[model samples]
Structures are given as structure tokens and as C-alpha cells.
Target: MSGGFKDAKKDGSDPAGTSMSNGHMGIREISAGVAGGKWSAYEITEMYIDKIKSMDDRIGAFLTICEESARAQAKAVDEKIRSGKQPGKLAGVPVAVKDNICTDGIRTTCASRMLENFVPPYNAAVIEKLINEDAVIVGKTNMDEFAMGSSTENSAFRITKNPRDVTRVPGGSSGGSAAAVAAGMVPVSLGSDTGGSIRQPDAFCGIVGLKPTYGLVSRYGLIAFGSSLDQIGPMSKTVEDCALMLEAIQGRDDRDSTSYRGEYQQDYAGRLSGDIKGLKIAVLKEYFTDGLENEIASSLNESIRRLEGLETSVDEVSLPAAGDGLSAYYIISSAEASSNLARYDSIRYGYRPKEYADVDELMEKSRSEAFGTEVKRRIMLGTYALSSGYYDAYYKRAQKYRKLLRSQLAGVFEKYDLILGPTSPVLPFKIGERSGDPLQMYLADIYTIIVNLAGLPAISVPCGFSRDGLPIGLQLIGPHYGEQVLLQAAYALEQDLKLGL
Candidate 1:
């Protein structure tokens, strides 16, 4: 923890004494701070530094805080602001990137020891956008190693505790970003959702999470897990804030092979301005499978009624292979993980153990000591799936099922504008609740993986709360290239629900 980190439970709020402006101000406040000379970018940066240093000991959201680089950038933004030039839409805004996204000059650990000391010489595509937009990179957040787990407990350094309840888990891979935004450490952050990393935690913390269409955002610098599934997105306290970040970072990045062609119109806020009269919405009945908790089921039902009240016709649709989402996700992702991670040898660019004299010994020692158990397990499983004898049984079969899942989603999209469902089958569990049980933890992601598998877009908006006070999230899944529809529907539903920004 840094010296400037402030404890939320102890200091409560605004260590920098920055005042709150009705939640609507969100990203707008960064401009207000600069315009009024109320706080320099340096001061705002220091304030978050103080907050993170204080709260991280408990929340453990960040894997590493780029203090020097952040301070330096903030100082420059302050100079630009003082010079009477627009620092950009996100002037002085502090954003946290999930660890899997590469950041130049900083260790991109991915919350795994395997790349503990690995510092890339170049920034990821998203990093370039944030910097170009004058957003200060606060730090890299903790995540499930290679995004292999649901709860952040799989992280090598520490698990991200939910900001709402410290005893519970923050949803994984993007947990650190989700928790950071929810706890108000930073107004907005970016998280990757291969399954529900962004959405689930957004639900857990009562925030907005958007999983854009697979190619809507470039994946050039994001470490690959499931190449077909992973998509990076914004997590924020409000829809506008989410839109602000998304508009800045999204669009065509030619560097990424999968990047969308031409300009994909960078106006999400405009899309949100759509009137929601007579829009068709579908609630996937398959989402309410046997394992969902009673409370989440009820909360989702209420959210559907709220949509119906807004003049949107809501009906039930079934995605037959939705139940197989988790199964297919694990197999495909793990196989890809096995292949993607093969480059982390001690030979170059990653943690190398000093105790070994021979090549084989060095590689073995480095990986064995640096990599966590869950990562190793996936590596093994992935390797097995891709192995000669079992390739067809595991890897190929999983791909076929993935095709089935995507086709099923396509069929649903033919009738409805969006599919509504639970982001997670239940609310976040205890911190150590699913630690020892891999299968159970994997099940927590069952509801989310299908979206990733289908390469569609989804958002998790706070719908209601459980009897125990935990928040329930309703996921809005849309067809490929459905970012506009997803945002419009989410914005309208959010307005109707009126559950705080």
C-alpha cells in the first residue's frame, strides 16, 4: 500500500476533501475540478493515491500502483489545464486498467507471479487511448490469473474484496476495476469481460458494467485467454461515465486484427438518447435454470416489469445451450490459455528464478515457484485438451458447442432486441467461501460465460437487492455489433429503475 492510500472504513470519504456533485457529474467533475482550480490533477491524483494506499490493505483491488508515472502525468495535465487548453474529455480523470491489459513502463502482472516482474516496452491499444484523452493511468488492477476464475481469490497477490461487503468476493478478472469504481476510489475504470468479469462485479458493487461487442473494442494489447470471447469494457457509477470512457477508447485500432472496419461511430451517449417506446426485450428463460437463488430470480422479474412499464414489450425466450455456456467456455478458454501462456518461459521477458543453473531447471523453477496453482491447473487442462489423443474430444468438441451457443444466441436475436438475465446465478459469496472448491467457483460464472462464448455484448445494471442486502444484477445481452441497442436499453431501464446512478 502507498502512503497516500486512505481507508474507506476509516477515513470514510474524500481524503482530498473533494466535494461530491450529484452523482450525475461523474466524469464531468474532472473538468469542474480543473475549471474551478479547486484541485490540480496532481492533488486529485494524490487524493486517489491516498485513498488506494489506505483502502487497498483491506480491498486489495490494485496489483500495482504506478505512483511515479501517475504523479508525472497528473502534473503535466495540471500544466495543460492551467495553460487554458482543453486537456481532453477526461482531463485529469484517473482510470485503472485491469492487469491483463499491458501498460508500458509498469509491470503487467495479470495478478499472477508468472509475469510478476514483466514490464512491457509498449502500451496496449487502450492505454494509448486513455493517455491520448488525458486520462491518468492510476494502476493495474488485480484479476484472476489469465482470467481463469470467477472470484478474484485466484489472484496470486491477493483477492479483491467487494467494496459493499469486505467479507465477500469481488467478481474476477476485472474485480479490481469494478471494486475501484464502486468504492469511489476512481469515478471510472476499464475491465475485460471474457465471461462476466466486468458485469458480475458491477452487480456485486452496484455499478454499471458494459461488455461491448467482441470487436467493438480492439484487443491488440490485451493478453489473450479465449481469443473468440474476451472483450474489454467500462465500469462506472453511471451510464454517462461509462459512455464517456467507452467513446474515448472504442473505435477501430488497425493494430488489432479483429478490430472493426472503418469508424464505428463514437457516440454512445447519443445512442442512450433513444426513446424506449415499443422496443422488444427478451428475458432468457434459460438464465433462470435450476441453480439460481430465489432472491436474484425475484429481482430479475421485478426489473423485467420495470422495463414493461416503460412501454417496452418484454417476453420470455429460451437459449437452449445457455446451460452449456460454462462448460464450453472452460474448455475453449483453458485450451487457449494453455497456448497463450506458452510464451512465459524463463528464457525471456518474465520472471526468471536465480537459483537454477541449467535451462530446464530455470524454466521449471521459475514457473513452479512464480505461477499459482490455478494457473498451472488450467495450463495442464488446456495442454491436455490440445494434446493429440484428446484434441477432438476436448478442444474441437468445445468449439462445436461454442458454435451451437452462438447460433442459439443468433436465433434469439432474430425475435428480440435484447436478452435479460442474471449476471451471476447468485450474489457474491464469502471471501473464502469458494476458495477450496474450483468447480463451485466455476459454477458462479455459468450465467456469464454464454455471452462471452457467443461474442455478443452485455451489461450488468443494478436491478435490486437481495433480502440479505446484496445487490442483484440484470444482464442485458445483445447480438453482435449491438452496442447501441445494449446501451439504449440499459439507459432506459436504468432511468426506470431509479436505483441511484
Candidate 2:
């Protein structure tokens, strides 16, 4: 089995089917192989590099491929092992980062033309962690422009295809990161979730995606969208891989005021006992109601039964305010976005118009030319919400509703250890299915917005598949800073199913 390599087929292109075992190679397997001298760090890195170069064409998961830099990084890890020195837990593993996260000297476009040529002078906090752990920086994956849209189709660069079915859409904003892991281009990748960007893509692409509690992962070098809502997380093919990646990046950063400084540390991966015999899990009644596809409902019901068979105490819970979460999320996120995006007015940085009659025209031309349609729509909505006349009526009301939803979720979490539901309300649709209708596109994140609003941690893991062979995801949402419990429960289900690995 060519775990991360291909023998070069008749057309000189590697088919997506060629993989090591189970059609995917995980971070743990690669790290162990490199650590034990079974394979050099350089060899492991090169295998993925080769596979990505040969296979990424069909998937379009990456916007920038860091070939030379990645080779240099792998060589340094190889030297460390050759010198009989200690290596980091993730030594020699190849991982991709979402484009919105900055990497010093690498162009971080955020899948928007406005910053197409903007390269940060310093790395995002998460990139530093990946480097410290000796992980190879494979490249930056594509994303929805400024992480705004639900489908990657909103990307100004290109649309990322689902690895399972090329004709279908991969769930967005973080679709590129999810597709990279799903297609075997990389074992694990980093993604940001504001409103199901990470978990929804994981569900669509058949992988594991974890959105850590807000402030648990630093956001300094992550380009702001909705400042209060954006949280970076890990996307991988297995639950154990997600835990390992999460442990590497979660911590406080002096640069980010929102970052948390917890008491000591916990073994996020080592604590995985895969024992949930007495875990208290609740199924949200609101998530199972209208608009959920029949197939997804059936799959989720089966997943609940599987958990019950493990002796977990499962019950139904309701957070009525959650029904209003989508509306509130859009209002709040767009309002925050309007303020955050003011920096791109063509004065100091970002795209500038080639010709303009005056300062006003320059700003207008630059923005009109650089920003995409969806981005423009949100900016307008956000601006209107924050405007003087409508501030109290729109933004204030949304904030109040957001607080109500958060408090409701907090009450539910106090009673149950975790909340279980479908990661997405439906399966992956056609690429252009909802692009023309913003309301329908926003509904794609209906099941996920409340978690971000509440500042809690959540994960999406492959539980089953639709009749069309597309994947279905089961979501496990935990209270603020409750990732350990979420991972344990998710690990139990993943182990029982042996999915996607």
C-alpha cells in the first residue's frame, strides 16, 4: 500500500484511491514510523509532498504549495533524529494550514483578492506551535473569502471539490483544509470555525474537525473576520489525530489579549480512555426538527443508538433561543466584520486602484474592485446594522438574543456532559446549489452557529454516510474549556466505528 505516495499511473497523475492502509495515512502512524527509524523525516515529508503535487489538481484544496520551504524543514528534522536527539511529539508530520492564518514570508490571501499579495512579517500563533512540534509546513489551503461563506465556492481563487465526490461541494470557509486531509494530501490541517466552517467541512469531507473554545487558541496573526467568534482548530482524518493537533496549538499568547492562561496543562491525547459508559449526552430537539434531510436524520438516529449501546445516558434537551441563532449570528458577525474590514480602504495596505480622480474615488474603486460580491453584501449589512438609526433596532437586539442563546446553552451543559447532534443539517450539495441565495447558504450553518455564539468547544466526526456515499457527521459540543470530555466521548465513538482511517 502506498500510504502517502503513488507509483504514477498511465496519465502520470496519481488517482485518489492510492493510499497506505484504509486509503489514508494518519499523523500518529507517520510520526511513529519516522521516530523509530523505519522512515526518515525527509522521506515521510517527501512522500506527502509528491502525493500533493500529483493529486491536488482534481481537488484544488491548496492555494499555495510550499515545496522548497517544506523540504528544508524536513531536512532539519531528519538531522535531529540522525544526531540521536529528542524530537517533538509531531516530528516530521506534514500538516496544511488554512490560508487565513498568517505564515511569516508566505502570502496569506484569505481567498480574497484584497490581500492576494500581502505576506505577514510574522507567523500566526498556531503556525509557531506547528513549527515548534517539528511538523512540516506543507502549504496554505484555500478558504471562503475572509471566511465569510459556508461553501468554498465563495472563494475568489477557486472552488475546492469534495474528496469523496468531486462533483459535490465541500463545506466551507475551511473546505480546503478538510478536503486536503480527506484526500490523503496531508494527514492533518488547521482550520478556523466561526459558524461551522471547520466542523461542517469535516462532515462534508468525511473527517474529524475540532473548534476549540474561544480564546483557547490565540488569534493574533489570524486575519479578523468576526473577532469575537473566530477560533482556529484542527481538521484530520481521525479523532486521535484531532486530539494530538489540538494539544500542540492550545495555550495563551502574550500578543493576543483574549488568550487564556490556564492552570498547568492536561494530556489532551494521553487522557483518551475511550470509555464513555456513564457519560451524560443530550440530543438537541431543535436540531432534529424541520429542514433536516431524512437521510441525515436516519443516520443521526443510528449514531444515538450506537452511543446508547455503549451505556451512555442519552436524553432530549431544548434550547428554544437556538432557533434564533442563525439570525443573531449573521447580525453580530456582520456587524463585527464591518468594523474589522475598515482597515482595507487602500490607504496603508491591501489592494489599490490603478487610477482614481480623488481620495474618495480611490477608496471606492479599490474596494469595489478588490472585494467579492458576498463580502460586499456582508459589509453593507454590517454597516447598516451599526449605523446610527438602526444600531439599537438591529445590532443591539441581536446581541440580546445572542446572550439569551448562550445562557440557554450554558444551562443545558450544566445538566449534561455533552450535546450531540448532526454536524450539518444536510449532506454536501452541488457546488452552485445555494450560491445565488444567501439565505439558503446561511442555513447550511444552522446547526453550528450557536456553539460559536456560546464560546464553547465542538467537534464533527464521521458517523455514517448518506445513500449517495457522501459522509454524515455527528457533532459533540462541550462547555467552555470542556474539550477533554468532548474528545473522550468522540474517541469512544470513533474507535467503535473505525471511520476514515
Candidate 3:
């Protein structure tokens, strides 16, 4: 299929009664078909369930499949339509949620053993919003343990393979969410990005992923990794689907203190006019430095040329503070993680050891036995950084650097409508390629971490492919709360590129 579900008939006609199962259909087509009575929501849900059952064993994208609940949701949607009632925006579309986003009664594991069996009593704000829109939650996708690693190999359960290349990683810790959309298991999925968790994985899997401005979406029930840096976003097969999902989930919530209280555009998808003429886009010169792969660099250059052809002005700019983003992000995020994860002692609701000498040993052994290596490593690093003498030297310095980076990015936005760059410096690598080296794995997110550090909006869209057929992605970053223009520009480029999965 071409970009934006071009093959699907717009007259709401069902071709051969199997278009719902076609894997290439976009969100609007499926929802509209179900609402218009051209197709039943049950049929759409069943087709997606069947696809997941047949493909998930090989892909390892989902940790749990809520077949029973999904069917119940689909039937409810069909009943609502039959009663002559108007359905919500995402009427009958099936959505896969990252395991970290709590769904009431559906075990939210966060792909970590510590909370492997922990069932949340409440739904995350995003989950409640999605369900309110009538979206069906198909299952919870896997991720790195507590979202600590670059490759999904760090998951205590199983590694998520890239749908484009099984031998390669799908990127993490949102790899499973990206793979689910890439493999067509679902039209869209939710993933949390602390430092490139969402965009890096989307780039690897050849899909669209958006990290909304911090506080655009509520974080009430998300398992905190880096409380300040983490933001929940949508991963989808196309940019239109991404925008639709974002519109469904974004709003002000009284429960989350950090939730954005400012008013903004509501219909993100409806605002896609594809008219980005005279848009000034700045290219970060530091992003094109040494470690970038040749194919990705070439793909980014071509994408820039495409934007130029669209009458948008493209110019190279430098942000020296961006070069130090990785260091600051790790320190700040890890320190937050260390504090957030401290509540998981044996005395709490999570995993607990049967044997312990005392309360001290219970907490110690519980963490030691349940936490993965990467989680432990980060906790230690964060604990050290937050320690007495070293606090100023490390964590404090990182915070100062973060402020400088945000200031520099804000300056760029004053002159440019958006910033463009490669989503990842390297292509999707083999599963075990960099897992053994922590520093190397951290470097994989060099191009993406700065967006999170600044708490700005950014998206990764498929640009082209490598010679070996691996998908390459280009990133488009917008000013805080500028998702409208950001998405319009991305949708225009996506229509121009016409790259199909």
C-alpha cells in the first residue's frame, strides 16, 4: 500500500470482506468502516487477534494478549453503532500498549521481573483516554527491563526482534511497541520515551513515532523511569495514525501535576493541510558528525532535498550543547530512576523473597534477585551521582548542562520552524552486537536524547531504506506544543516519499 492508506477505497466499500485483516489499512479506514456499518467491529478485532496469535510467537512483541477483553470492547462498539449512537474518534480500532502503561486488571509488567505479576488497580491517564475514545486494547507489548537498555535484549522475558530483520534488534526500550505496529499486529501502540526510547525504536522498525511535549499527555499511571524525562506517545504505521492517536490521548488532567494546563489545538489529524511552504527547518550540524552511518546520512540528505523541493527553506545550524546531551540525560534520568524505583522493596506490592533475615535483608534480596543487570547498574550510577560529595560534580552539573541545551534549542526555534536530522546515528544492528558494551549502546541514542532533554515535541518518520532493506528514519522536531505544524510538515514529507511497509 502507498502512504496514508491510499489503497483503501474512500467510499467505505469493503473489498472482498477482508480489508479489515489486510494489515495495511490505516486507523481512519478501520474506524469508519465499523461505524458506518460496512463492517462489524467484531470482525476487525477478530482479524487483528488472529494475526497476533499467528505472528507473535515469532516476533515476541506482546507480553500479554487480552483476547477476552478485546472482544468485549469490540462488541460494545458494535452495539453502540447499532443503537443509532455516535461512536468516539477511535471507535473500534485495536491498540497495543507498552507494558509500562498501566491498564486496570491487565497486568502491567514493564518487562521487569520485579513487577512481573503486578496488576495495577487503576489505568494510566492515556489508557483511560483511549478507552473513552472507544479504542480496544489488544495486549501489552514487551520492553527492556524497567526501560533501562537500548536493545530489548535486557528484558527479563524475551528479546523483541525487528520486524524488518529478525536478526536485528527493533531498538528499545519501546522495541516491542514499534514491532507490533511494523508487523501490522495493530495499527498503533503507546510507548514511553525517557531518552529516545520511542523514536529510536520507531526509526529501527520503519514506522512513525511521536514524543509529545512534556505534560501534553498525563503521566498519572505510567511506571516512572525518569519521571521528568518520560513521556507517553503513539507509534503507528503512518503519520496520520500517529496524529489521530495523539489527539485522542492528549488533554489536561487534574490528577497529574505536570500535565500541561495551557490550551492548544484539539484536532491534530484534522489540521494536516500539507501546506508547509516557507517553513524554515534547521539541520543540526553536530548530528552529522563521525559516528553516523553512511546510508542513514545519505537518506537524511535526500529527505532534506525533498523538503527543499516542497518550498521549505533548509539550512545547517550548530548547537554545541547538543553534543553533551547524552551525558546530562543519563545522569538526570538515572537519578530520577533511582528515586522512583525505591518503592519496590519486598514490603510493597511487587515481587518479594520468601526468605529473609530481617526487613533490611528482605528489601536487599528482593531488589537483588528481581532487578536486572541494567536496572541495577543505573540505580548504582544514580545513587553515586546523588551521593553527598559527588552530587555537585555530576548530577548538578548535568542539570546545568540541560538548561543550557534547552536554551540553545529555544534560540534555534526563534529562527526556524522545525529542526531536522537523522533519528538514529546507526542502522538497526544485530541483537547481541552492542549489548555487551554499555557505552556503545548508550551512544546509539546520541541523535535522539536531546529532544527528550529539552522536553520538546519530535517525530520519527520513515524516509528510505538501506541496501540490505533495513528502514532508515528522519526526525522532525517542533517547538514545545507545536505538534500541529510538526505533524503537517511530517505528513507532507511522508506523502512525498510514499514509502510503504
| lDDT (Cα, tens digit) per residue for candidate 2, span 1-501 | 353333432233454433335346567767877788877778767777777888898999999999888989999988898899888889899999999999998889999999998888999999999889889998999999999998899899998999889989898999999999888788899999999999999999988899999999999899999999999999987788899999999888999998988852558888897688989998988898889999999988888888998899999988788777888899999999999998888888789889999999998999999999999999999999999999999999999998888888889988899999999888999988889999999999999999998899999988988888999999999988999999999999988776544
Best by lDDT: 3
The TM-score, computed over Cα atoms with residue i paired to residue i, of candidate 3 is: 0.96
- For model 1, how does the per-residue alpha-carbon lDDT over 23-106 read when each residue is reduced to its tens digit? 223677765665468667787677777777877787788988889999998988888877888777787888988999999889
Model 3: which ten-residue window has the lowest total lDDT?
Answer: 11-20
Question: Over the stretch 1-501, how does candidate 3's per-residue lDDT look in tens digits?
Answer: 332232322322322222223437788988988889867888778777877877888889999999999999999989998999999889889999999999999999989889989999999999999988889999999999998877788999998999889999999999999999888778899999999999999999999999999999999999999988999999998889999999999999999899998996788898787688999999999899888999999999999999999999999999999877888888998899999999988675888888999999999999999999999989999999999999999999999998999999999999999999999999999989999999999999898899988999999999999999999989999999999888999999998988856
Candidate 2, 199: how far from true, in Å? Answer: 0.6
Candidates in order, TM-scores: namely 0.93, 0.96, 0.96
Q: What order do you get sorting by TM-score, best first?
A: 2, 3, 1
State the C-alpha lDDT per candidate: 0.81, 0.88, 0.89
TM-score of 1: 0.93
Clashing pairs in 1: 4-50, 5-50, 5-53, 5-54, 6-50, 6-51, 6-54
> Which candidate, 1 or 2, has the higher TM-score?
2
Pairs with steric clashes in candidate 3: none
Which scores higher on lDDT, 2 or 3?
3
Shift in Å, residue 365, candidate 2: 1.2
Give each model's clash number: 7, 1, 0
